[model samples]
Target: MQRVKAVICYDGTHFSGWQVQPGKRTVQQEMERALTRIHKGEHTPVVSSGRTDSSVHALGQVIHFDTTLAVPEDRWPKALNQLLAPDVQVMETSFVDSSFHARFDAVEKTYRYRVHLTKERDIFRRHYVYFYPYPVRVEDMKQAAPYLTGTHDFSSFCSSRTDVTDMVRTVHEITVEEDGDELHFTFRGSGFLYNMVRIMAGTLLEVGKGLRRPEDMPAVVEAKNRESAGNTAPGHALYLVEVRYE
Candidate 1:
């Protein structure tokens, strides 16, 4: 058996997230179905680097699968794209050592959140950006971002629905940039808890809008309580930008 690594990009507008559910349409389900067809009815499982929530898009999601087929690496993307839905595409593929596991081998990940700060909504970007019309003090958000960076218990920003007890994660960076009426928040970290980025974005947004003080961020992180954080932003605005591996 050979392990194949593929870089995937998807719109995530209509699917039920990356993982396969009993009856829901999902990115993994579509990928596995295509692989199954490629192997002539044999089931093949594709493992992703991480699970993204419903409506959360991806520019560089990575996955790996073991296959017995002899398809060439250069043709993998073309072959898979032909079978996948229009919204999901396999951008690149290559053979790797059998020991390379997409999830286990990942060393870092970057996620981007887009926020639209205009009074009128742009229908074209409605599916990709969070609409926050309230005036934001961008500098204040930047100041608060540093407090959330580095290693800490992120339980306050994680979703209560998650069962994972370990809330500690290292955030290498959190950058907020403004371009016209849009604010781009990029987060790079070792890993993230369920809904962690969204909650952090919401908390930072509160600070930006002057509803919360930037100094409160350190206290929020220290509290380790979900109630200490701000609201959880919607998932549609988040994008899994890239995953890194050593």
Candidate 2:
């Protein structure tokens, strides 16, 4: 069998999520379905770097699977793209070492949350960017973001329903960048808990609005309570930018 690795980009607007669920459309299910048809009735399983919530998009999500077919690596993507739904596209494909794993081997991940600041939301970009027409101090959000970097127990930022007992993760960096009428919150980390990035966006947004002190961000991290953090931002504006493996 050949171990194949591929990078896929998907518009998650209509997906239930990445994983397969009964009676639901999902990225994983579609990927596996395409592979099943290629294998002529045999079941095939695909594993991903991580999961993205419904309405969340991806640009460089990684996945792997073992296949018996000896199809040329260059042709794999072309074969799959013909079968994948329009919203999910296989961008790159290649063979990898048999021991490589998409999830456990990933050493870093980058996520971005986009916010469009305008008096009126753009109907064309409505599903891609979060629209906020209110006044916000970008400097305030920048000042408060530093406290969220480095290794810490991120219990306050993740969802309370997360099954992860170890909430500790290293956030390598957090940058808030402005481009014209848009604000981008880019987060690079070792990994993230469920809803962690969205919560961080929400908390920093609160800081921008003068609802939270910039210097008090450390205390919020120390609190380690979900209630102590800000609200969870919506998923539609979040994108899985990249996943890295070493």
Candidate 3:
């Protein structure tokens, strides 16, 4: 069997997320179905670097699968694109070592969350950005971002339902920037807990709005209580920007 790695991009507006559910339509389900057809009814399982939540999009989600078919590596992108829906596309593909597991071998991942701070929301970008009418100080958000970097127990920002025992993870970087009425929060990390990024964004938004002090990040993290953090931001505004591997 040969292993194949593919770069995928998708607009997550209509699907139930990246993973397959019992009856829900999902990105993984669609890709697996397309692969089954391409492999002539052979069931092939595609493993993703991470499973994005419902309504969260992706620009460069990586996935891998093993197959016995002899299709050229260069043909995988075009072939898969032909079978996938317009919203989901296969950007590129390559043959990789059999030991390269998409999830296990991933070294880092980056995600960006966008917020539209305006009185009136843009109809075109409503599906991709979270709209907040309240005023936000982008500089304040930037000032608080550095506190999130480095290894820490992110239990306060993680969803309560997360089953992972260790809440510690290294955040390589956290950047906050603004362009016109759009605010972007980019986070690069070794790994993330369930709803961790969304919670962090929400907490930062509070700081930007002057509702929370920038110095409170340390207290929030040290509390290790989910209630210490702010509400979870909408998943629509979050995008899995990229995944890195060594």
Query: Residue by residue across 1-246, what tens digits does model 1's lDDT show?
Result: 989999999998898999999989899999999999999999999999999999999999999999898899888999989999999999999999999999999999999999999999999999999998888899999999999999999999988899899889999999999978899999999999999999999999999989999999999999999999999999999999999999
Predictions in order: lDDT: 0.95, 0.93, 0.94
lDDT, candidate 2, 28-57, per-residue tens: 999999999999989999999988998899
Residue 225, model 1: lDDT of 94
lDDT of 3 by residue, 63-181 (tens): 99998989999999998899998989999999999999999999999999999999997999989999999988888888899988889989998998867999999999999988778
lDDT of 2 at 123: 94
Candidate 3 weakest lDDT stretch, 10 residues: 135-144
**Which runs of model 2 end up more than 4 angstroms from their true locations?**
none
- Model 1 clash pairs are none
Q: Largest lDDT belongs to which candidate?
A: 1
Q: Against the hidden true structure, what lDDT does model 3 obtain?
A: 0.94
- What does the lDDT read for residue 174 in candidate 3? 97
